[model samples]
Every structure is written in structure tokens, then in C-alpha cells.
Target: MDPIKKIAYNCRQATYLIEKQQISSITLKEKIELKIHLMGCSICKLFQQQSMLINKMASKHFADQHKHISLDTQFKEDLQQKINDRLHKN
Candidate 1:
């Protein structure tokens, strides 16, 4: 296989890299491969976006670990509704 082809990641690998990237630094080769893969793969790109958003939300929500906080009731209800809808759909 060509070197470039060998470096190209499948969707599963790309997603793993996407998640790994959030928690730690990937090697330069992996970064390059992931960047190239994301450029060509819209699905993986979307996954990366969603993962980043989730991480940002979680970080923000948990930033004050010692402080008391509560999830908004409206947000909880909305999330529950969405989950119920998806479960019924399947």
C-alpha cells in the first residue's frame, strides 16, 4: 500500500482519534491523518463537532466541583422527551 493510503483511517479509527484527541494529544502522524480524514469525511467531522460540544458542556457544568448546582428543570425535561422519542422511534 502507498504510505499515504496506509495512514488513511477508516471511520471507526477516525472516531477513536476524534475522542482520543479530546482527552490527550495525538502523535503528529495521527494528527495529520485525522485532519486529512476529517477533511474528506463529513460524518467524522460531525462526530468531532458533537464530541467537542459535549466536552465543553460537561467541563462547564462541572467546573465548580465544590459548589452546589442543579440542572435546569426545563433542560432535564427536554432531554428526557428527546430520549423517549428516540426510544419509541426504534
Candidate 2:
């Protein structure tokens, strides 16, 4: 197989292993791999970090929604927009 295909396969396998919980999220291997990947591949590293964080937060149950944006900062703006019909005003 081509080197590109092999690299992609390896990345896919790594992601699968992580997603399938085959690797200890807190293990030394996980930490090292994450750091190394982050150094080499920013996009995949970011994705891995976010995916792992979500999985950990969900406790492997795969909840319907992963997170809620607290209405603390944007709430006021959203509330004002709603009241003023800002989104459709234009």
C-alpha cells in the first residue's frame, strides 16, 4: 500500500483504539501518544483531545448532548436579540 494510505490507516486505527476504550485514557502511553501527535498533527491532535474529553465526560455512555454553553456570557446578547428580533431585523 502507499505510504499515505498506510499513514491514514494508522491514524484511523489509533483513533479507533482510543474511541473503543482500548487504551487507558490516563495511561503513560496515552499521554505520550497524545503529546507526540499534537506536536506532529495539530488538527488530529485537537480532534483526539476533544473526542477523548467528551468520552470521558460522558463516561462511555455516549450521551445525546455532550455540553451546554452556559448562558452566562452570551445570554444577555441572545436575550436582547430575541426581544429586538435582531436576527431577522436585517
Candidate 3:
């Protein structure tokens, strides 16, 4: 199979790379592969665009929200204990 075709046909890899690229830089090979795949795949392109928009909106909202939010130590400890209890039960 052609290497480009292999990359282009794997929507799963294309989508994973789309998300990975947002968090950090993908390698040169990965960037090229993802570019090739996105050019041919409309669905993956839409997903990439939507992912960018969502990340942008979340960053904007969270930046403001973080300034106003705080949790006391006791509440944090109780929440952690409940999470631990749930994990142990599972």
C-alpha cells in the first residue's frame, strides 16, 4: 500500500494527530501526514476546525472563571476521599 494512502485513509490517526497538534507539536513526518490526510478528508477537517473553536472558547471562559473560583482545603480533602472510596469500591 502507498504510504500516503495509508495515512490518508486512517481517519482515526488523522483525528488523533489533529488533537495532538493542538496540545504540542507533532513531528515533521506527522505534520506532513496529517496535512495530507486533512486535505483529502472533509470530516477530519471539520473535526479539526471544531476542536480549535472549542479549545479557544474554553480557554477564554476558563481564564475568567479561574480568577473567581477557590475551594477550601477541607472540601478538597472530602472530595478526594469520596473519589478514593469510589475507586476502591470499583
Highest TM-score scorer: 3
TM-score of each: 0.57, 0.34, 0.64
| Model 2 TM | 0.34
Q: Write candidate 3's Cα lDDT for 1-90 as tens digits.
A: 798889989999999999999999999999999999988999999999999999999989888877967899999999999999999999
Against the true structure, candidate 3 reaches a TM-score of 0.64
The C-alpha lDDT values of all candidates are: 0.85, 0.62, 0.93
- Candidate with better TM-score, 2 vs 3: 3
Displacement of residue 50 (Cα, Å) in model 3 is 0.1
Which ranges of candidate 2 are over 4 A from the true structure?
Answer: 2-5, 8-10, 20-39, 60-90
lDDT by residue for model 2 over 1-90, one digit each (tens)? 975445444666556555655354456765555445445666676777899787687775555464653567588888987988966877
Q: Which portions of model 1 show Cα errors greater than 4 Å?
A: 1-9, 60-90
Q: Give the TM-score of candidate 1.
A: 0.57
lDDT of 3: 0.93
Ten residues in sequence with the least summed lDDT for candidate 2: 17-26
Residue 11 in candidate 2, Cα distance off native in Å: 3.5
Which of 1 and 2 is ahead in TM-score? 1
Off by over 4 Å in 3: 63-90
Superposition-based RMSD of candidate 1 using all C-alpha atoms, in angstroms: 13.8
Model 2 per-residue lDDT at 78: 81
